[model samples]
Target chain A: MPNCDKVTALVSASLDHSLPLHKRLAVRLHFLICVWCQRYLTQVRFLREAVREHPERLESAESPSSTALSPGARERIGQALRDDRR
Target chain B: MAGNLSDPQTWLEQHGDYLYRCAMLRVRDATVAEEMVQETFLAALQAKDRFAGQSSERSWLVGIMKHKVVDHFRKSVREQPVSDVELMNDEFTGLFDKDGHWKIETTGPKEWMDPSSALDKAQFWQVLRRCLDGLPPRTSRVFALREIDDMPSEEICAAMKLTKSNLWVMLHRARTHLRSCLEQNYQGLTT
Candidate 1:
């Protein structure tokens, strides 16, 4: 019997499609009785879906998001690419 | 000719910002992301004849950016930090009880309240991106490469110079953190 610790770990790997068939079966069996692990699995899947749907925001100086890149950096890269063209 | 592949200025105007965002999400640094996008443009220009009119112009550029992202990680392979292992262990321990079972009441699933709709909303993605950013940089990179880019495990291991187990462990920790973060932060937004 795969314990909850191993089962939860397997749930994560399962998302990556990395788990083997037997372990996957074991996880499925574990999930039968473990509502908590099942919920954990759902949460992970939800996170994955939410992320996949997250539109990639273009880097902007005024955007407060951490994903923003500096305008100077963008200009420097554009300049480098232009130089490469010449 | 059919697409904007031949025009550098148009490519920069159309896809530069988008490519920069993709690269930035994976590499998590301003300077590095900038370099990767520039490299992608140069590579796209050099391989213009091979464009084949297959994928979208943005995807073709993104394909090149993916390679640049891998190459950047390949060049900077550092010793796996001890803190990573410690953090993984801590996250694991927190999720399971001593008997290797969930602490039940605390871990029960609450109503996600129209999960699909919440997922479709832009606000949910903003929160999701913020949650991803909160993860440790290395872990976030691995998760983004594997989940976001859909990069193969073998390629991720080879490019990042990670052992299979290490990659699995890091991915597990990343998922655990992301799940909890979403639950805490976005539960209110759902439904």
Candidate 2:
């Protein structure tokens, strides 16, 4: 029987790639008794879905000035673009 | 309308900020993100003839920026040797005991009721951004590449020069930390 710590790691790994059968069974069996690990799996899955589905949410939540291009960068890039044309 | 391109002069004023933010989220560096945004625009300008107008100009620029960001990572990975110290440190040791069960008192997963609803709120996204910011730079970078950029694990391994196992461990650590951080911080926003 794998411990909760091992099972949680497996659960996280399952997201990136499919787990081997024995390890998958171990995680499933552990989840049968351990509600905490179940919550862990759910939360991680939710985190992935939320982040993946709504990346633009970060843009909306962020203050514009913080992530925006600085005036200097804007000027430099603009000059580079103009220079490329001429 | 075959050769029509959106005016390049209006690009900086219109799409510059949005492109910069997209680059920042993936690269996580102000200067590098700026450079990437600049490169993306220049590359787009040179390749203007290739634009089929199949997608909106913003989406077209975003597609180019994605390639630019990946190229940046590939080049950086080649130039600098990867330090595995952070990845190998097992930062979660305190969360588990010798018996390998969760410590529970301080580290067990908390139940987050209505987790999906939290996503609809602007505050929840803000908390998530902060949690992502809290991760070690390498961990967050790996997480962003995997989740945000939707890159494959094998590709990530090849680009970062990490073994498959090392990539798994880094992602596991990132997900665990982000899960806990969001549970603790965003729970307040929900209630």
Candidate 3:
């Protein structure tokens, strides 16, 4: 039986791609007796889904004053655009 | 000509903030994100003649920004020496014991109750942003590209010039760190 350490790594990898049969079986067997590993899987899967579904949450959650484009950058880009036009 | 493309003069006033925030979320750097938004605008201006208005102009610019972000990634990977030391570090090894089981005392996974509901909480997103910021720059970039951009593994491999296995390792490390960070930080908020 794969230990929790190995099982957890496989659990993370399983998110990226399907595990080969033997590795898949190993993870499943470990999960049967391991609540911690089970919780790990659930939490990571939740994290992935949360990030994938609502990425805007992070943007909105960010402090606007910090992440927003500065006036200087805006002017620089505008000037570049105008220069391109001419 | 038939499309509803906005004038280039108005792009900064209109879409600048939105585009900057979008790039900031992905790139996690103010200067680079600003540069990306700018590049996207310039590219859009050059290609404005081709805008078929299939999507909103904002979405069209966002599409171009995505390419810019990916191009930034590709360039960074090219410029930096591809080192495996960071990827092989395995920071979580201490969480496991000699027998490969979780230590269960100091570093085992904690049970988070109703994690899905945390997604609705603004504090949760803040904690997530901090956690992502805590990751190694390259690892976080790879994670953002894969998770946020929804880029496929093969495309990520090609862009970063990483083998599939390397990409998997970096992503696994990123997810592991973020999961633990969220469980520790966000779990505190619920209690």
Candidate 4:
């Protein structure tokens, strides 16, 4: 039986659609036995659905290019064009 | 028009940007990456006859760029300090039991975690890149080739001259470091 901490995270991950098959079954079994984990899983499911249903913020924690490159890096690419020409 | 080797400058002009971009993506440093790109172009110009087109020109440049990045990191960054958290190698294996059962609970039959959202967060991406930077040079090289560059595991094994176990160990270490880093970043905040 997974304890509270592991159960909470598993529920969170499950709500996020991240739990793998075997682990998913184990979490389901635990949820059946433990009401706290079940509620936690419910909250997670609700929040994830809310997040999905709503339009995400432009700066939400999910953008690949959000980690902006240092300023001028893209502009600096033009330097390569000029330098290689000579 | 493309077969001539006497005009090395023309070849450099034609493909220099491609070479530099390949090196930059691998090394993540603009200045040193630029030097490596120049060297790759020079080397290719000298040995253009060796190009048998086993891969596309972009991929060939990437192969050469890989070697250059590895060589540069080995020569320079390998001696830097690696944190104790990152030094933990076998802990991620704790997720598996002696019988190969997964210890973590999963709610669904998902095989992969979509960390794309995690990457979207600027703070998370910063932490992730820092964690990657902390990996041992060779391990980071292999990990970057597989994860960031999207190279096949077999290609990484061949390119890095590592065994399958070695590859998995390196990847495990990379993930462990990144996960712990992200967890630490998340632990203090109420998000």
Q: Write the per-residue lDDT of candidate 4 for residues B1-191, one digit (tens) a residue.
A: 33533355454555555565445445655577667766666556555678766676655655676677766655665333334444454554454455433443532212223433443455654454455555665665665666555567676665556666556555655544544455455332223
Worst 10 residues of 3 chain B by lDDT: B79-88
Model 2, B56: alpha-carbon shift in Å?
A: 2.9
TM-scores for candidates 1 onward, in order: 0.83, 0.90, 0.86, 0.42
Among all candidates shown, the one with the greatest DockQ:
2
Ranking by TM-score: 2, 3, 1, 4
Order the candidates by DockQ, highest first.
2, 3, 1, 4
Candidate 1's error at B59, in angstroms? 2.1
Structure candidate 3, residue pairs in collision? none
Q: Rank the candidates by lDDT, best first.
A: 2, 3, 1, 4
Better candidate number, 3 or 4, judged by lDDT:
3
- Docking quality category of candidate 1 according to DockQ thresholds: acceptable
Flag regions of model 3 displaced more than 4 Å.
Answer: A63-66, B1-7, B48-57, B79-85, B88-90, B188-191
CAPRI classification of candidate 2? medium
Candidate 1 lDDT over residue span A1-86, tens digit each: 98888888888888766678899899889888877788778878876665554535322211243444467866776787779878
Candidate 2 C-alpha lDDT tens digits along B1-191: 43556788889999899888877777778899899989999999888888998888888898899899888888887534445566535567777889999878778887776777777888888888878777776677789889877899999887777788878888988898888777778765336
Candidate 3 local lDDT, B38-133, one digit each (tens): 899889988988998888887788889989999987887663544655564666776788898887876778777677777788889988888887
Q: Which portions of model 4 show Cα errors greater than 4 Å?
A: A1-86, B1-34, B40-117, B186-190
- Which of the predicted structures, 3 or 4, would earn the higher TM-score when compared with the native? 3
Name every residue pair that clashes in candidate 2: none
Best by lDDT: 2
**Per-residue CA lDDT of candidate 2, range A1-86, in tens?**
99988899899889988878999998889989988899889888878888879877875456433468899999999999999888
Backbone clash tally for model 1? 0
DockQ of each: 0.47, 0.66, 0.65, 0.06
**Winner by TM-score between candidate 2 and candidate 1:** 2
